[model samples]
Target: MTRSQTTLAADAELTGVAFFTGGDVRVRFRPAPAGTGVLFVRTDLPGEPSVPATIEYALELHRRTGVRRGEAEVQLTEHVLAALAGLRIDNCRVEIDGPELPGLDGSALGFAEALRSTGVRELDAPRKTLRVHRWVRAADGDAEIVARPAEGHGPAAAGLRLEYHLDCGPERPVPPQNFRCEITPERFLEEIAPARTFITADEIPALRAAGYGERVDAADLLVFEPDGTVRGNAPRFPNEPARHKLLDMIGDLALLGCDLHAAVASRKGGHALNRDLCRTLRAAATRGDAPITEAIGVSTDPAAA
Candidate 1:
């Protein structure tokens, strides 16, 4: 009875979620009074069109994740939606102007704070949930995504276990990092969520030249030089880098719009594998497949996706 699992938003609070750093852009999660689920709106536009959290609206670009409805679009929605969905928030509108979301602290912490502070309220109505009914798996070079149901998991989870293998150089301050965790809000915050976004010195020049994460500075994200943090960082949690990878996975997976419930195991999993897993999983669930518990896959010290 084990198959792949598939798993957000609308007025359903005007303030359940909100905007980022750019004063020009406004990003907020508004509740759909009709319980239409959460919808992300871009108020900067004249009409302030909406982008519902669904596969149809998601744009399938490998560079950076984005969502769209007709011509309107929102990019890098993983962080905010991940925090919202992880915190068990199911309804709100996430509105923004610009295409890319601010990299922010590079962690889900900021988004998590907003969702928790505003909070989720249960309606007299029962929430809609997607149950895992099949088995599904997708993979790319050195990356793979698998979804299965929880053994006895509750509604709050779409089981997840993410792994990362970092190969460092002689000059690299970081070592070969690896981490694993059963994805959950508590586990997310404690083990996976706090891990900050990071990039090696080798990539700094390209990032700056490409104008990536412009809203953030070295202090905001963990920019490890050949030595280490330029000045310093919150403190390396040994597995912090791997944990951060998990954080990205959580955020990206949230885009699937279902509470992921499975013994999900990912390796080298970035947005590509993460999003593909969600798509594959959603397809399986939509077709009515049962969820699985223990899955058969390589458990790398730092798993790949």
Candidate 2:
């Protein structure tokens, strides 16, 4: 069965602390017409400039994914975008009164639950879908993300699948973890949405020194100690970090502005490598090329997000 486009049935609001700024932000998700895609409206700005949630508008920042329009930018948007993609929301207006989104529980659960409560309505138009006819890979030193055509399944039968591998080194705080799964709305909520964002215990001081995560604490987010133990929180899954990485990948990939049918594999990949791949895909789509077997070069600089 062909899927129809979707949007919120009604408006919903969520307010909490912005991840980096520690400022209070209220985000309202409102229904939008078909083909609007996802848009971020800055209510705090004088004219409420809107930024399209697409690769063409994505901005490169440290440890986070964001989109900008002129002087307006939204930071730490992965969780909310993940929630929207997990719920299969095709078009909506994400209105916020701040520069960053709230870090509710450091996971996508809150956003997903709020959207579920607001309800989803199928739009009259058919959903937009993208197909990968060949392999495309982007690498940034030890980190890499690859997208390849799904084998065996017909063009209409195949759906998006994510296989993620994470390693912070055996001597590092977090242990090696890997997760592979098909990404469906139900599966995402049940398996991926609750996985919280994490940071190493050693990085806390640097982050605090840089004036970040002011409102976050050990109990509010995951903090892996040097001994591979959580500081104040417990892992929802044995390999929660890997799952969360997949969650971030899904969120970042949503910038494609349409449903995608492909098999993606990532090794120590984060926002930087993901964005690079998105840029390559957008260029390929713009050129209307099929079977783009050419390898897209990845950045060699190390990054974490």
Candidate 3:
């Protein structure tokens, strides 16, 4: 059975400090028409410039995902994107009053809960889905991500599967962990949304020196200590780090702007590598190099694809 596109039924709001800018920000999630995908409107800007949440507009930010259109940009977008994708929300207008999104709990749970409360409304159009026909891979040193076709061609097989292998190295503060799950709303909310972003304790000083995370504290996110313990927080799961990596991959892949029917495996992959994989997929779709199927229409333009 084909699924219809969906959007929020009513407006929802979230407010908190941005991890990077350390400034208070407010974001409003509003319903959008079918095919709108996810668009971020910078309400604080003069014209309230909007940026489509697609690979075409993605920015290569450090440790986070962002998108830009001319002078307007939205930073720290992974959590929001992950929430929307995990819930299968296809169209949304995310209006924000700041440059960065709220860093609530350093996880997607806040956004997921708000969106769930707002309710999801199905649109009239059939949802677009990209079924990968060939393997696509991206790598950087030891870190890598690979996307490939799922087995069979039935509706049951037309879902996403993700596996992450987070090898922090034996000497690192965090231990190696692995997580694999089929992407679904219930699974995402229960197993993935609450996993908080984490960093090594030693990376804090350099982040501070780079003028980031000024207002963030150990309570905001998981800070792994040298002795393989979290500072001021308990692990949500024994493999919470790997789960968070999977969450990040979900958000980054949302830039593809369609339902992805593929199994993706990531080993120590980060935002840059994830974005690269999206670019590769987008290019393939544009060139008709991949045997992709669409429920409605797929953009062929290089800028839109």
Candidate 4:
């Protein structure tokens, strides 16, 4: 089956305080033509410079994913990207009046909900897809991500599947956790999008000293205390940290600018490792070393059941 490219049918907007800057930010999602991909336009800046949300523009930020186009930069983009990618929105123009996206609820649920309300429109163009044909891996100490070809055919075998293993060490607040899921709009919204970003209680002071998350409170996100308890919130899932890891991977992998068909596993991975996997897969696909498929459409299998 062929899959057509998709974009928002109408405009959608969200507003909140940025996680890093602690300033008000408004993001507007506008529909774009097929093949346009995702572009972030700095509406607040002079001339409104735009940055393509592709691996080529990806920047290694502290504990977050970012992209830059010369002097124009957007920080903490993973949640928004994850929302768009999870919904399979192929083309969009994301206009924002701030350097960073709003950190609403520290999850992608808000963005996903807003985009869903706008509905999606299919385009005349076919969707671009990349299928992993060989093993590819990226590692940083104990943190790593690996991708390999999917087995079988049809939609179920041609979509991305992710598994995450999170272990913050025996002395850390967050305990060992695991999560696995095949990427789908429904599953993403319910199982992954609501998983909020979290931090260890001890890391707060250093983050503050580095001028980040000043306006953020425990209620705005998850902060695990040393006693292995959330400071001011409850876990949406028993293994929400692992699910959030998968959420971050979905966003970081979206930088590929195409649908991915692979079985990817991560162990204690973060933005840096996720981006590294994207870079590796992208390089392989660009070199014609990996199998490239187009418009495989949605999966029809009940593997996620």
- TM-score list, all predictions: 0.77, 0.94, 0.97, 0.94
Using lDDT as the yardstick, the better of models 3 and 4 is 3
Clashing pairs in 3: none
Tell me the alpha-carbon RMSD of every candidate.
7.5, 5.1, 1.5, 5.3
Residue 114 accuracy (lDDT) in model 4 = 100
Q: For model 1, how does the per-residue alpha-carbon lDDT over 173-284 read when each residue is reduced to its tens digit?
A: 7666677666656776666666777777787667657655445566666777776654356645877777777777777776655445555666666777777877666555
Model 4 whole-model lDDT (C-alpha atoms)? 0.88
Return the top candidate by TM-score: 3
Query: How displaced is residue 178 in candidate 2, in Å?
Result: 0.5
Q: Find the 10 residues in a row with the least total lDDT in model 1.
A: 296-305
Residue 295 displacement in candidate 2 (angstroms): 18
What's the TM for model 1? 0.77
Candidate that scores best on lDDT: 3
| lDDT of all predictions | 0.59, 0.86, 0.91, 0.88
Task: Give me the displacement of residue 187 in model 1, in angstroms.
Answer: 3.1
Which residue window of length 10 is worst by lDDT in model 4? 296-305
lDDT of 1: 0.59
Candidate 4 matches the true fold with a TM-score of 0.94
Q: How would you order the candidates by lDDT, starting with the best?
A: 3, 4, 2, 1
- Which sections of candidate 3 miss by over 4 Å? 291-296, 302-305
- Lowest lDDT sum, 10 consecutive residues, model 2, at 296-305
